[model samples]
Target: MIADSGRSVAFTGHRTYDGTAAESLSAAVERLYGRGFRTFLSGMAVGFDLAAAEAVLTLRAAHPDVRLVAVVPFRGQEERFSPADRVRFLRAVAAADEVEVLAGGYRRGCYAVRNDFLVDRAALVVAWYDGSPGGTRYTLRRALARGREVWNLHPSGGGLAIRPVQPALF
Candidate 1:
């Protein structure tokens, strides 16, 4: 099922995180929940995606209405991950309320397709970005272009900042 954009949040971030990433993500999730975001979309990649999904799982214990959606680029996307990461990925997928695989197998630009899928369904994006160029930047730019609210949980220490949507430069 396609998520209700008004209530859905998409997450994007780096593949690795620092020590305080977990705590910061958990707090951000809690805040978003309090603001009535019921659905969270995770790209289901290794680092920040897994962290976001796990945080939602933790929150689900107290608020059953919170939904976690794992948006996989393709089936078996985790096959290349290390054994431990593969296990983590499986656990998150199993626990997710909904799993949407965009492709039957890995293909060129599949990851970008997955990212677009998340942004298309979510009105709010929660990002763990340090401003480096990559998928996170691409997704954030897409969200901005589409006028989605983006909350950046800057892992480098600036805390959560809600980015303003810029007016179209047409």
Candidate 2:
């Protein structure tokens, strides 16, 4: 649950990556914290989702009041995660102040619908997209259309840097 003054930020992005993108994501989370965000919502997927959740948990060690909410697409989805990632996903869900599964099971097009749910509920979105055309891109587009703030952390074939862009201002 989000505090009255705190903003809820959801995460969406690619599920495959090299090491550089992963590090960039960690830095982006820290940047969000510095900007006064207190709650984070993650879809609990394998790649970017797991990475974002772990970053939030890591920040919790220092900022114990920060909350991580697992917005799962469906129950038992974590079972498909790799052994290490599965452990992290379970930890995230266990440590989260709130866990909401958008659907009872994996229905066709459910992940995309789940992403939309996250986008609708969040005040901001932190995405690690590699310019791919997929669910993450769809979520990013929706976030922009809703006038929500979105911070893109993907490298544009350049050095790793945090680029914060206001979709509404664009």
Alpha-carbon local distance difference test for all models: 0.83, 0.77
**Candidate 2: worst 10 consecutive residues by lDDT?**
157-166
Candidate 1: where are CA atoms >4 Å away?
A: 155-170
Candidate 1 clash pair list: none
Highest TM-score scorer: 1
Put down candidate 1 lDDT per residue, 1-170, tens digits, no spaces: 85588889999988875434676678778888898999999999988888899999999989999999999999999998889889989999999999998999999999999999989999988787777778988888898899998877663522323442212200
**Clash pairs (backbone) in predicted model 2:** none
Instruction: For residues 121-162, write the lDDT of model 2, one tens digit per residue.
Output: 888888877775788878888888888887876655212233
The lDDT of model 1 is: 0.83
